[model samples]
Target: MQRRRLLQSAALALCPAACEKKRRSPLPFATLADLTSMIQAEQTTPLLLVEHFLERIAQIDRSGPRVNSILELNPEAKTIATTCKPGLLHGLPVLIKDNIETADAMQTTAGSLALRGHKPKRDAALVTRLREAGAVILGKTNLSEWANIRSPNSTSGWSARGGLTRNPHRLTHSASGSSSGSAAAVAAGLAPAAIGTETNGSIVSPASACGIVGFKPTVGLINGAGIIPITHHQDTAGPLTLTVRDAELLMQVLAENFTATPLPDILIGARLGVLRTQSGKHPQVLALFEATLQKLRDAGTIIVDLVELPNAREAGALAWKALLIELRADLNAYLEQRGGDVRSLAELIAFNEQHRDTEMPHFGQEFFAQAEQLGTPEIIAAGQEARKLAMQLAGPEGIDAALKAHDLDALICPTNDPVGLIDLKSGDTNERVASTPAAVAGYPHLTVPMGFVDGLPVGFSFIGTANDDAHILALGHHFEQLTQARRAPAFSAG
Candidate 1:
């Protein structure tokens, strides 16, 4: 027995390299760039990548940790992979947020039961762009119902159709919203990356909470034709990825009038301003911010402290008012064109009331009801004016003014507070987040994992003026390289 045990131990010791060949290809937490390289080098085929991810979705997303990030997987993904030609994305499998329409076997319900089985006749412009770039549509991810516009008191990751998407880092924590599933899936290594939309903090907040990179580009930069609407002024889809470089690559494929610009190789002498007002009230987050600032300083960055945006409070309030007013009109338009039985905001409200047991069990649709009440033509005109003023305040007088005044390239702040507890009774308890100014202004916002606090992740943000997507991405890439702070989630049962 002793001789047999010794022989077995020796065999196990020699099996690492041999056994590794039989293990999963591409490894866990592989970035999109890494996958692209593997595909280009013929190290892995597209079908293999799809199969591997499908298996992971079964193991990690569905069963093991039960992150429940995906709403539906593409039944045709493997076949699509086998036929996909070499291009920018080149057989990569990418997940789409449910709000974005894809004309496929999978449904795009935006997490609302009313829109169940609602598949579009044509792909959303961004989905078309992904297809053109040789990406296989892997699946649709769950989201906050109606992109969290259904209720002012809604729990962010909970949907009547998809249930709740838990944070991969800690099961008890909130995944933020409405891009919760997209962010969680990327952080959990279910896919190389996922696409998410942001009306306010939908992309960045969830990305920060899940410890990944989320980039919200200028609103109109990517075509917004087929996405379910909140407000056209504030709504845009962006990439959530494990690295800023992957975000950049996805943006290159998604953006219209694509232009490639050379980015700086290093962060030395890079000038940045700190947005103190939007920085959260969490002490630990603030400490992490300070430590990150010192790291930047040590890396030869010029940090300008405490730059305040003018009329930030007023801008946010006006933006909210505008969103409420626009919601009814924009959503009505989308619903009508979408050719669904629930074809209007009023009808949608009624649909929810009829299905209250499923849809309204946890929270009421106060925002939708409020928006339905404000359907007067006069209110819509007022909303347009408010949108104009908000853009001026948050864009020219806000982010741009601060940058020009300080002669800085961009603004930096904490992306969000640490992950809050998942509370269905009280709904989301998110504190101050740095996504507002950029979100309202339709500028570029990039969040990269900064560090952890008490086993939860926080992100450092880079906010820049309109059409400054490339510069913001470059800045975030530099910070990511310098700090290397992003760690894969352990799926702890906290």
Candidate 2:
């Protein structure tokens, strides 16, 4: 309460009239385009915008509802806001997942105590792009410890350094992660948008659970350097935002040579294949999916039903093996080059053991130990082979085959089950998700709000072939305009 008061005072000091109105309005929930227009109209300055968000973060995130999404605030945020020059995202503040690096006061620990004070020598490549595009590095958000790669039984949003990030829509429910905080913060209006990384469901699943838009671009589209590694083959950072256009704007800034070609009529005569096999078993979720299909049909899109990707199981298994192998190789190189006190995967495992009570309170580091064991030259070579085969099965032979056979522009499915109860002992109950095929194939996947089931939000996905991000975005943008499905979180207890 005292913190909230201080933030309120800060807002009033920043801009008396605007702050008073902002306090009573839904400015926190405003879209990027809305904020940009306000900035251009001289209604709000960058400093004032930062102060307003700081107040929101204090009121709900820390005190009132206690969403616990942000891990740390960028101490220099106000200063940067005042000085940042005009660009596409001028004056916008964006929260980043804890796994991504920022050369600032905030630590990029990936929500682990192992690297509690670790700071990168420079910002991650995407962070650099965001700064160049005139965005304020608002803070680092809590994430599943080590991107939910530690244990099979680990909770989705619980992390040693940042604790658990709860769903803003329902406090008791899970904020599906490893991008939990990023999604939740945006949903709760702590920030307009946030950056989340995905090797698989990290971005889209959480966005689905939080009622927002999550876009995972083709893996190589965005630079992966300086981020804490998972697997270079499938890892990429993308935007989690209130709208698909916001995601597209960030993508333009993050991915070089990328341009947003507005296709207001792209949905007309478009062929979208429905991946029924990937849709979950929830009755209401399925019903909502069917309703969404009908809405697309009404919008002149041709829906191809029962279009399933081939060899998904085989591709997933292969990708798992490859990720385990690559985790060791990729992480070792990153930690060594970063010059951290804990410098290798082996040392990181030992650090967890040393801090077992805090770091392993909910689950163990079995995945890290397994990766460490698979570190032979021959095994590494075999893992590379597995990665190659997995890409083939998931990409050319899977998503590509399905699209070609149906002459589809993209594929569609449910992004995830509804937000579940947060169970630390049992871990995440996300048994069914549509993130794998596109994730393994290193293709573009975008999830927008479909509708709600008993007050909990679900997502509709658009999966396209590699480098087909623009078309996929166009489809999502059109759907977003058609349905206007996204609603601001009510911060209710369910």
Candidate 3:
């Protein structure tokens, strides 16, 4: 009660979330891998480069600077960064979401105050891959508290411990979440590239709002051995990057599932499904999508008119239901077996009760309490039906059905409506259509910077079925290779 009361006092300033577009944080227009080259060419050392980023954080993050995406910096970064070796992206700096673990100094809390001091014993599989590939782990960025599982109606990017991350594009605008800080960090040049995982819009939504490239590969493409739990059925890590090439570069180095292969000029004879229903997005976003589509058509790409999936809505509904059930079951397993300093979900609720002073300051623990009681057979049985319904509706029934009908190699849609204004008292307006279907179905989805709206960026997405991942990536790469629409934001005074 004490924690809640104190937190509620400042809730207006950072209530359900902080106000968006706080300031115009224009970014240095650049690519991620290019920074690696500049570092290697003796133009800068990894230490100096990392320091420059740290300086940027000092200037704009939520603390002194108040951009507010980063939770903690790795103290050993400067010491470890000086030792760069041979690899595709040797010495590139990476910012990871707090949910992903690293055997480093920083604590992985998924931005929840519950485990603020808890530390993982070792690196998650992807982190290990990044280290092996010669990339430096910069630090952990914030997320929608607990990857946005705390509540169905929870605000994006509002964590009690980390606060809310603002978008670099327009400060008062929503940066999107659960990968909020990761995307904002990339857009703000706090780090060259960052890893963001998604069950639904966790990765892609933020990447879209931050006006960067976000990629969610086919499930199982990347191993998930040591990350925080969500729906195991659809969760996967991806790149929220500045360019398609940069996103792809990160993927090549990270995915142990593949041996690195040089990509040729991707084929132009691809058939793409233009999701007309997705056109009702913000006019500015639609304008950019049309331009990109016209460019692809002019370049000899086959554009197909694909109708809406008959069961897409049902699939979306089921995906949300399954996530709630899986979150309870998966989080319980992780919290119980992980043997961390933090207690179980039920205990967490009690801790929040005991320390409601800090935990429930901004929002209540309704979801946590619900999860605890949901272990009953009624909830389990209902959850199972939802899961089954989702698989049939989203999978072979919907997207696949459309793909087969159109002979589509990929489907193109606006990543989301332009980033909305960040509001504190109320949570997100939550109006945006995402590529979440692809995410929920465990398919491959890629968002490339298509154009800017209000001087801020939004991306165009390409989604494809599992095993057909290569085709979609190729299509995205081809468009990205041609239309380089991405530009870093300019840090403007509010």
Candidate 4:
């Protein structure tokens, strides 16, 4: 009751006019379309909207539930909201994952204490595009430390600088990562949408767990420059949003080729290969997936069952080897270009060792240490081989092969298991994840809320071949329309 009173008082103080308006929105789960419509109806100003969100962050993130999703807020957010011009996004507030650079007062730490005070001189390429489209850069959200590349036994969403970001659905559960904060913030209504980068399960896993829309565009659809790196081959940023329509709008702004052909009536008679190998273990998740497939069948969709990604397991393993080699080269290059004190992978490992109390409280940098052991010659040769084999096995021989062999338009599977219990001592306990094939193939993967598992949300994934982002997104949008399965989090107790 005291927390509720505090939140009400803060809202009244910070947004008096909006709070007094009889018909004003009370929840923070506004989508891009909802905000644009509110603006069109003269119901809200961008600055007022920004204040509402900031106040919500203060009330919920810092006060009540303490989601801890946001790390550093943009001090200039109000000024940006006041000055932003009308465009695709108008005045939508966007929270970026902390790894993405912004040439502002906020630091890009990638949730690590070692890079705590480091600031990049320029915004990441996607950040620049988003600003150009008239979105206010609200702030940076917490993420899995170093984008979850520091340790093999690291907990997802637990960071030295930002602490642990909790699941909004039910506190004390994992939000999954390395895009944990982005998903959590969007789910909790702290932000309408957020930018999340993924290498493997990062984006889709979190979005699924948080019960929102996560779209990982085909690698190279959006430029990855200026973002902290895990691997250049697989790292790409996309949006985590309340709805698929919002995802499409954000993708249009981010993708280099924005010409998305009008979505054909893809649902009716569309052949979708069910990735039988990766549908996750949780019975509730499986039940929800089965129900979702039934919906597709009722809508005239043809299900291609028993579809398997050839050599998928082997390819996933090879992809990890590729990431280690790429991480050393890619991350060092980024660190050097940013001109930070920790300019190399070796120095970063040393700094973490020196700051053991804070940086290694829960996990050590075994991944970093392994990455540092490789010389450039071995890194390059191994990276080339791993990338080559993984791409072939996951792409043409994996997703593409299944699609062609079954005459399918796309592939579908469970995005991940339900949100796991947060266990810092044992680290993240996700046992069933279905993002590897798309991640390794450099393909577009879209995960939309499918249904719930014991009141916790789960999602279904749509995977398409490279540059088939529009098609998969269309499929997801249609699925979202048919199911309308996403529900706002209940903010359940620990």
Task: Kindly indicate the candidate among 2 and 3 with the higher lDDT.
Answer: 2
Better of 1 and 4 by lDDT: 1
* Number of backbone collisions per candidate: 0, 0, 28, 0
Model 4: runs farther than 4 Å from truth? 1-19
Sorted by TM-score, highest first, which candidate order results?
2, 1, 4, 3
Error of 3 at 370 (Å): 2.4
On lDDT, the candidate that comes out on top is 2
For the record, the alpha-carbon RMSD of candidate 2 to the native fold, in angstroms, is 3.4
lDDT of model 4 at residue 21?
83
- Structural similarity to truth (TM-score) of each candidate: 0.95, 0.96, 0.89, 0.95
lDDT minimum window of 10 residues, candidate 2: 17-26
Instruction: Give, for candidate 3, the lowest lDDT window spanning 10 residues.
Output: 18-27
Best by TM-score: 2
* Clashing residue pairs in candidate 1 (N, C-alpha, C atoms within 3 angstroms): none
lDDT of every predicted structure (CA atoms): 0.90, 0.91, 0.77, 0.88
Task: Show where candidate 2 strays beyond 4 Å.
Answer: 1-26
Which of candidates 1 and 3 is the stronger one according to lDDT? Answer: 1
Instruction: Arrange candidates, best lDDT first.
Output: 2, 1, 4, 3
Candidate 4 local lDDT, 263-379, one digit each (tens)? 766789989999878886677777878888999999999998989778899999999888888888888888888786899999999999899999998989999999887757967
TM-score of 1: 0.95
Alpha carbon lDDT at 472, candidate 4: 88
Clashes of 3: 28
Which stretches in model 1 have alpha-carbon errors above 4 Å? Answer: 1-23
